[model samples]
Target chain A: MSTGRKYLLQNVAPYGGERTTVLLADGVIAAIGTDVTDDDATIIDGRGLVLLPGLVDLHTHLREPGREDAETIRTGTRAAALGGFTAVHAMANTTPTQDTAGVVEQVWSLGREAGWADVHPIGAVTVGLEGERLAELGAMAESKAQVRVFSDDGKCVHDPVLMRRALEYVKAFDGVVAQHAQEPRLTEGAQMHEGIVSAELGLAGWPAVAEEAIIARDVLLAEHVGSRLHVCHLSTAGSVEIIRWAKSRGIDVTAEVTPHHLILTDELARGYDPTFKVNPPLRTQRDVEAVRAGLADGTIDIVATDHAPHTREDKDCEWAAAAFGMTGLETALSVVQETMVDTGRLTWADVARVLSETPARIGRVSDHGRPIAVGEPANLVLVDPAARRVINPDEQATKSGNSPFRGRDLSGCVVATFLRGRATVMGGASCDEDVVARA
Target chain B: MKHLLSTGSLSHKQAVRILDTAGQMAATQAREIKKLPTLRGRTVVNLFFEDSTRTRISFETAAKRLSADVINFSAKGSSVSKGESLKDTALTLQAMGADAVVIRHHASGAPHTLAHSGWTNGAVINAGDGTHQHPTQALLDAYTLRRHLTGGGDPSGRDLAGLRVAIVGDVLHSRVARSNVQLLHTLGADVTLVAPPTLLPVGVEAWPAEVSYHLDEVIDTKPDAIMMLRVQRERMSSSGGGFFPSPLEYTRGYGLDARRLAAMPDHAIVLHPGPMNRGLEISADAADSPRAVIVEQVANGVAVRMAVLYLLLSGNESNETKVDA
Candidate 1:
C-alpha cells in the first residue's frame, strides 16, 4: 500500500557494531550493505546504536473496557511501542474479560484502530476468569480475531481437570494457555511470598511451592495432552526448577519471568510499601538470583512485562490493604538492562532474543520479532545502552503512577522504535505526531 | 494507606509509625468531638462476607472517626446469601462509588484476589481472611504494649526494642496469633509461642519466633507480656480431640490463672485477643487486673486502624505535596 526509501544505518556489524545503515522500502529492510545512492531516500544515522528485532511481549495486561482509569488499549500500546515492542499479547483479565469470541474481537479491533503495536488478544481459559468452567475456547480461536493465546492470567487455572481440558482443547489451533500457576490451597492466606521475610513481616505466607506445585502439574498435563503451556510470571527458584525439569523432559512448556522478579526481592516488603505487593509476590535474594540463572541458562524462555497497572488508590494503602500490582511497561527494558546486561549476565543478543524474538515466536506473532536483515519487516529498535536515567512515575506514559522503581537510576534508553518501517519513537521520545496520525 | 488488611507486609518502621500515630488517635478518642476531616470526601464500604462483631465495629468506628462516609454491607441476609458471587458484589460496590473496601471473608485469599483481580479500582483492606493475618489487631496490641511498657514517651516513634512477649493457646486456627507474631517481630520484640502440639499449626518452626510447649517454662523467662488466646471450642469439635482433658484442665495448666499471673514479672501485663473465654483461658480477676490491657487493646484497635489508614493514604499524598512544593 505504501512505498518509501529509508536508510537505518550503513555498514553496521550484526551483533556488536558502532555504526551501521539499514535501507527500508515498502515496510521491509531494503538493504544493509555499505552506502548506496538513492535520490529520495531518508537518511538516519545509527551510530552507537544496537538495532534489535522489534520486541514482543508474551504477557501484558492492557486493561481496557474496564478500569480505563488505570490503562486503556491506546495508552498501553503506546507505552509498549515506546518500550520498543512491535507486538504484545493482551492478557484476558479485563472487566467483562476476553473469554468469548465477541470480547476477543472487541480487543483486536481496538488494537487495529490504535495501530501502534500488533495486539493479540488472549482468550480467557475459564469463563469470567473464575476457574470453574471453560470458556468458548474453540470459538475464540476460530474468531476473526484469531486468538492463539488463552490465559486466566490474573488468576491461576487451578483445577487439574480443567487445566488439562483447556490444554487439550487449544491443540486444535496450536494455541498456548499461559498459566498463572499458584496452588490455591497452599497460598490460602498468602499476602506475599512465603519465606523468612513473610515470617518476620507477619504477613500470610504465599509459599513458592504454591506456584511450583501448579507448574509441575501443568507441565505434566501439557506432556500428557501433547499441547503447549506457557507459565506466566514464574516467581520462585522452585518454579524455575519445575520449568527446567519440564523442558528437559521435552515437554512443550515455556516459562516467562517478569522484569520485577528478576530485580526485586521480598526484602522490599520490610518497608511496608504496597507497591512491592504483587501476585506471585516477590521472592528472596536467592530466588532473584535463581530467576537470573533461569533466564541465563535458558530455563526461562522469555522476558515478559506483566505490565499490570493499578491506580494510586489501589496501591497507596497499608501493605495488607493495598493492591498487588505495579506498572511495568515503561520500566521493563530499563530494568532488564540494569539487572541483566549491566551485570554482565546477558549479552545484547541475548537481550534481543529473550525480550523480542523468542516472545514473538511463542505468541506466534508473524510480523514481529524478525531478525534485522534485508527483506524482514522493519519492526526494530535502536537502543543507546549506556544512557542512564532515574525512573520517574510522573513521566511515565501509563495512566497509573504505581511504579516501584521510582527514583531508582536505570541504564539503557530506547532511542528509536520502528513498527512496519514507521518511526513510533524517535530521539528517546514517543513520536506523538505519528501516533496521532495513526489514530 | 486505605485499610488495614494483614500484618504480614508491614515493616518495623511502618508498624512503629502506625502505633505512634495511633497514640495521637487514641488521644482524640478521649476528646469531646472525636472526629477528623482527613478522609471526609472519601467513602469507605465495609463488606463483611463472614459474621464478625469486633472487627467490623472497629473498622466502622475508625472510618467514621476519620469523617469518611461509611457503607455497611453484611453478607448475612444480603444478596450474597442468595448465591451472588464476590465479583458481582465488587461490581455493585464499584457502581455505588466506593473509594475503599474493608472486607472480611471466610476465604483466606479472597480479599487479595479482589484487590488484584481488576474487578474494581477501589482500594481493598482485608479485615480478616480465613486463618490469615488480622493486621489492625496486631497494631492495637503493639500500641497497647508500647503504652504500658515504654513509659509516657511515644512507643510509636521507635520499634518494640527489648520487649519480650509470650503468646499462649491456640495458634493453629487463630489469625490473631499469626498477625501478632509478624507485627511484634518486625517491631523488634522477642516473641515466644506457647501452645500444645495439637494446637500449633504445621510449619511453625519456619516462624521467626521461638516455640514452647510449657507456659510455666515460658513464665520463667519473665516476658514483658503474656497474651492468652481464646481456645475456640468449635475447633475441638472439628479436630475431634479432647485437646485438654477438659476446659478445667486447660485453665489449670496453660490459662492465665493467679499462680501463673504471679509468676510473671511485676510489670508484665496480660493480653487476650478477646471475646475472652474469661474462666477458661483467664480468670475474672486477671481479666480485670490493673496490669491487664485486654480492654485497652480493643479500644486501641480503632486508633491503630485509623493510624494505618492515615499513614498509608494521606502520608503519601502529603509527601508528594511537599515534594511538589
Candidate 2:
C-alpha cells in the first residue's frame, strides 16, 4: 500500500493468453495492454508469466489468539502471500473460539497489523464450536471486522434444528454459515475413510454416508428456510451427488472441494502415515472422479484451501492418535494446475473465477478477487505454468510440515504476488519491502 | 528374519524351518532337564500393552527354557497408565539392552511401528496385535498341524502342500484368523474363511482365502484342519465392532459342536486358539473331545515361540550354520 507509487509489469499473459502489459498505480490497475509504461514506476520483467487475481481462500486456519505455538496471523498470512492469496477467511475454531465480536476484531486487527494478507475472521456459529448453543452472530456481523461468514468448521453442527437455526440466523444479515458436514454418531471412533484400505490397515472407518447424510439434511434445511449454506470440504462422491441434486432442485447451497481431495485418495492411508490423515479423510478413486467432475462442471462452486496448520508433535504420532488435517495454503494452486488446468478441464479465466472471484463473493470481501483491469485493485499473482517442483515439506512456509504430497512433483509455481499493489512476495520469497503505515 | 511381525509374508521354506525347529524345541520340553544354553546371556522383555496372560506366559516360559532372562512389562499397572506413550516405553526397554522384545498391543500396527522405527537393534516378536496378526500363534498352529499330519515322516523342510484348512467364526476381529490364513496359504494350504456376513471384514474377499458364509458347507468339505476363532461377546454391540445376533444364535450357526466334530476326517483336528469361548464359538464337548488339540496347541505355543526367538535372534539361519560357526 504505497499510496502513489506505480508498477509496470512487462509482457505478462493475462488469464486467457494474448501477451499484454499491465500497470498498477495508487493501489489500482492503472492500465492494461500495449505500451503500458511509467517512468517513475518500478519495472518488473514478467516474461513467461500468467497473471491471475491473487487467490482468496474461504478457509484458512490462522491459529492465533490460541494456538500460536502452531501458527499466527503473521506467519499464516506470510504463507498465504507465498501461495498467491490476498485475502483468507480465518476459521472460527480457536482457543476460546471466535464467537464474539471482541475476538473477531482482535484477529482481524492482528491480520491488518501483519499487513501480509487480509484475514477475515469467521465468526463461530456455535460457542466453542460445540454445536450445542448459538454464538454471537449479529454482533460479529456488525463489528469492526464486518464478519460475513460464520462456521463451526472442525466439528459438524449435527442437530438438524441447530444447523437450520444457524442457517436462518445468518440469513438475517446476508451472511453464509459454512457447515462442516459430518454426523457424529456415524463417526464415533473414526480414524480414516471407511473402505477397503481402512479395513486392511485396521484403522476405524469414517463412512462416506455420514458426510452425505448430513449434507442431504442441511441442504433441505437451507431450502426450507431460504438461506445460504456453504458446505466445507465436500470429500465424498455421494456428497457431490447430494449437492448436485440439491442444486437441481434449486436450494441455495455452495460447496468447496479441497485441493487434496482432487488429487489424493484413501489408499495412501495404507502406510499409517499421519501426514495423509485428515478430517473428512481422503476417499476412493470413484469419489475423486466424481468430485473432479463436480468441479469441472459448476456443481462445485470454488476450490478453498482448508489450510490447517498443526505442531509436529500433534501430527507425527500413531494414526489413531494423530491430529487430522494437511497444511494446504502453499500447494493449492499448483495442485489445481496439476489436476484441472493441465488436464485441459479448466481455463485460466475459470481458475481466477474459482480461486479468486467466487471465493471473494462467498466471503463478501470487496477488496479482493477482483479482475485485473484498469482502475481495479491490484491484488494478483504471476504464475509460471511450465515450472515444476517436487514438494518438500521441509521447504514449505507453513509451520506444520504435514503435506500429503511431499514427494509429488507438481506443475506450476507462483513467481510473484501483489497484495493491493504492494509486493508481499517477489522471486518466490516473501518481500516485506513496503506497505501502508500500521494503524 | 530380524522381526516376527506377521506370517502372511513368510515364505514356504521359512514356514517349514519354523515348524521343524519348533518340533526340536518340543522334543526338549519332554526331557527331565528341560533347558538349554542357546540364549544364555540374552534378555527377552515381554512388553504387553494389552492384557494377554496366555501369550505372555508362553513367551516367558520359552525364554526361560532357553536360559534367556525374562522381564514382563504389563501396561495395566505400569507407567503406560500414567500417560507414558509407546515410544517412551520402547526407548526405556531399548536402553536396558533387551535382546528380544515380544510385544502384544491393542493397536494393530504398534509392533510394526516399533520394529521399523529404529526403536531398538534387537529382534522384535509380535505376540498379537489388534485384528492384524498373531505370528507366533500361527506358527504354533502350523507346528501342531505338521506333527499331526506328517504321519511318521521326519517332517523336516516340508510344506503342508494340498492341505485344506477352514478358519471359522469372527474373522473380522480375529488376528489369529488373519495370520493363520496367510501362513497356511504360503505353506501351500488352501484356506477357506467361514464367517457370518456381518463377521467378515470389507476386504476379506481380496485376502488369500476362500470366503464362505456357511460353516456347514466348509465342514462338509473338511479335509485337514478347522481352526475356531474367539468371538468377544463384549464386541457384540450394534454401533461398533461387528454384528452377531446372540451367543446362542452364533453357537447354532458357526460354533463347532459335538455333532459337527464327529463328522470330521479321522485325522482332521479341531484347533481353537484358547482362552476359548467354550460353548459360544466352540462347545465344551467339542473342545474336550479327543480330536480337539486346544491344550496341545498351548503347549506347542511355547515350543513355536522358542523357535521364533531362536531363529529371529540368531540370523534366521539353520542350526547347521550355528554348528559350523
Candidate 3:
C-alpha cells in the first residue's frame, strides 16, 4: 500500500489547546495550522474534538500463539485501535511463552499483517515464566521484533538471585525487566485483597505487602546492579510509597497503575462474581485513592491497560474457580477520562503524557507517543471527551466479553484513530480495509 | 429468607424465628413418629461437594422427618477445575426438579455462588463452605444455649440475649467459629473469640465480637457457655506456613481442660462442635463432664436444619405438590 492519499482534519484541538486544522500525507503530519489546505484532500470534520498522540499501552495481553479463544492479534489490535491505542506491548505469559526470538517475531509480524495497532511482544524474563532461569533475553532483543521489555507477568520472578540477574542481563542490551511483583508464598490461594472485605467474604487474603515487598526488593536490586526496573500493575498504597521512596533515592525505577486499580476496589468482590476478579486483586478504597494520587503526582509514571481477555468458560463459574483478569482495551481511555480528567485531577496534556508519552518511553516504543506536530508520524487519535456511554462487552472487538466496566457510564469516546497517517479506525469502528498493506 | 447462606446478614427477627421454628421441630422430634406433613410432597437434594457425614445425615434426617423426598447427591472428588462440576451438579439438581438444595463445598462462598449464579432455581442452604460459614451449626449451638441458659425446657421464640459465649480454638479456619460469632451476636449474645493470635484472621477486630488470646482469662469471666471449635490439624501445616507450632503448644494456649471447665459458673455449659481433637483443643475430662453438652448439639443440628429448609422451601411454593413415591 502507498501513502498517496492526503487527508485533512479540520478545527481539532491538539492536546486540548486552540483548534487548528492538521494535514496528513506520506504517513506523517504534513502541516498544522489555518494555512493547511483541504484542496485535493479528504476532509474530516473534527470540530470540538481533542487530538492526542495515539495511546500506548505498556502492558497488554493479546493472548495469541495460545489462548486465542480469548484474543488474537487481529482482534486485540483492532480493539486497541478502537480504544485509541495505536501501539501496545503484548505481555509474555502465553502458552509457549514469548521467551524465544522466534515467538516474538511471530507475534510482531502477526500484528503487522493485521494492519491495526503496532504490536510489540514483550519477552519473558524467565523460561516459560517459571522463574527458574533466564530466557533468551539477548536473542529477543537482537531479533527482528527487537523486544526491549522482558517480563514474567502472570508469575513473578520470585527468586531474588534470578531477579537480580535478569535485571542485570537486560541492561546489557539496553532493555528493562518488567516485573510482576508478587511474593508467591504471601499470595498463595489468595482470592482477593487482604482486608476487611476478604475476611468478611471468607476468601483467602492477598496482602498488599505481598506486592510492596517484592517491589521494595527489586528496586534495591535495580539500584545495586545499575539497571532499570519497571514494576507492573502497582496496586497498593504501600507500593506507591515504596516507589516514591525509590525515586527519591535516585534509583532507576518506573511503575504503572492499571486502569482497574485506579477506579475499582475490593468491595466489588463481595458478589463472588469473577468479572471483578483480577490478579493483584482489586485493593481497598484507600488503595484506589492512593493510586489516583500517585498517578496525579507522577510517582506512578503511566497508566497501562493490562488488557487481559478470557473466554466464557474461564469466567462463567465461581470466583475461586474463575480466571483472574478483565478485558480492558476498549474501555481504557474512557476510564482514564472518568477517573483523572473529569475529576479535574489531571489535564488533557497530562493524559497524553501518562497514557501515551510515558508508556511509550517506558516500553522503548520510539515510533509512538509522539507529539501531534508537523513532520511527526501521524499516529494519533481524535477524542470526543464530552461523549459518554455505558460500556457493553458485546459491542467490543476483543474476542472475550469479560469487560469489568460493563453497565457503567464512562466519558470520552475515540472518534477516530490514525496509525501512521492512515485510518485504522474511523467513526469509532475499525476501518475494514488495510491502512497500508505492509510487505 | 430465600436462602440461608450466612447468619452474618440474618436479622435479629429472622434469627429468633428460625430458633422458634426449631423449637417446634424439636417438639415434634420427641414424638414416636417424627415425620410431619409440612413438606410431604417436596424434594430436598443433599448436594454435598465436600464429605461431611454428620452434616449430610443431619440434613437427610431433617428432610425425611419433614416428609420431603431426600436425594443424597454426594459429589465429593468432583473436578474443582473452573468449578464446572459445581455448576454441572447444580444444573443436574435443577433438572431433577429438586425443591431445595443443601450444598457443602470446600471453597468458601460456593453456596453463595450456586445460589446467585442462577444455575438452579431451588433455595440454597449452606451446610458448610470451607472456613466461611455453617449457619445451621451456629443455629443449633444457639438453640442448645437458649435451651440451657434462657427459656429452660422450651426455648420457643427465645433469643440468647445477655448470654456470653466464648468460642475457643482455631478461629482462623473454623467455619463454626465464624458462623457462631455473627449469629450469636445477632441473637443478642456477647461473643468472645479465644484463640492463639495466629489462629485469628487479620480483620477480626471488625467483627461484632470481642477477641481474647487467653482461654483461662475468658474462663475466669464465668461465661454462660464455651463453644470449642474443632482444630483441623491438617490445615495448620498446609495453609501457608503452619499456623501453629505443635498440637501440644496449641493445647497449652487455647485448650479447654478440666480445671477451666470447673472454673465456669455453676450453671455454665461446655459445648464443642465435634468431631473434636480429644487431647488438643479439649481434654477428655472436660469433654465427658456433666457440664458438657456435645452430644445434644448433634440432635439439635437436625432440628435447626429442618427449620431452615422449612422456612426457605415452604414459604411461596407450598401449593405445588409433587410426590416421588
Best model per DockQ: 3
Q: What lDDT tens digits, residue by residue, belong to model 1 across residues B145-251?
A: 88888766655586778899999998866788888888898888999999888777656887878999899999999999999898976655543355556777777
Q: Indicate which candidate wins on lDDT.
A: 3
lDDT of 2: 0.86
Ranking by DockQ: 3, 2, 1
C-alpha displacement of B114 in model 3, angstroms?
Answer: 1.0
**How do these models rank on TM-score, best leading?**
3, 2, 1
lDDT of 1 by residue, A1-439 (tens): 2335364554444454545567777788877766654556666666666788878998888889798999999888888888888888999999898999998999998888887787899999999999999999999989988999999987899999999999999888889999998888777656888766665445677888889888999999999989999999999988888888888899988889999999999888866677899998998899999999999989998999899888876765446656778888778888888988889888888998899988888888888888878899988887878788898988888788888899999888887777788777778888875443463
**What DockQ does each candidate score versus the true complex, computed on alpha carbons?**
0.09, 0.40, 0.61
Clashes of each: 13, 1, 0
lDDT of each: 0.81, 0.86, 0.89
State each model's TM-score restricted to chain B. Answer: 0.92, 0.94, 0.94
Better of 1 and 2 by lDDT: 2
Error of 1 at B14 (Å): 17
Query: Candidate 3, clashing residue pairs?
Result: none
Better of 1 and 3 by lDDT: 3
Judged by TM-score, which candidate is best?
Answer: 3
lDDT per residue, candidate 2, A1-439, as tens digits? Answer: 5556678999999995888889988777889987878899989888889999999999999899899988888888888988989899999999878999999999999999888889999999998888899999999999999999999999999888988899998878899989899999889878888877766666777989999999999999999999999999999989999999999999989999999999999988866677888998999999999999999998999999899888877765556667888889999999999999999999999999989999999999998888788989999899989899999988887777888888889999999888778788888888853453241
Higher-ranked by TM-score: 1 or 3: 3
User: Which runs in model 1 stand beyond 4 Å of their true positions?
Assistant: A1-5, A10-14, A17-19, A36-39, A433-439, B1-165, B170-191, B196-209, B213-225, B230-275, B283-325
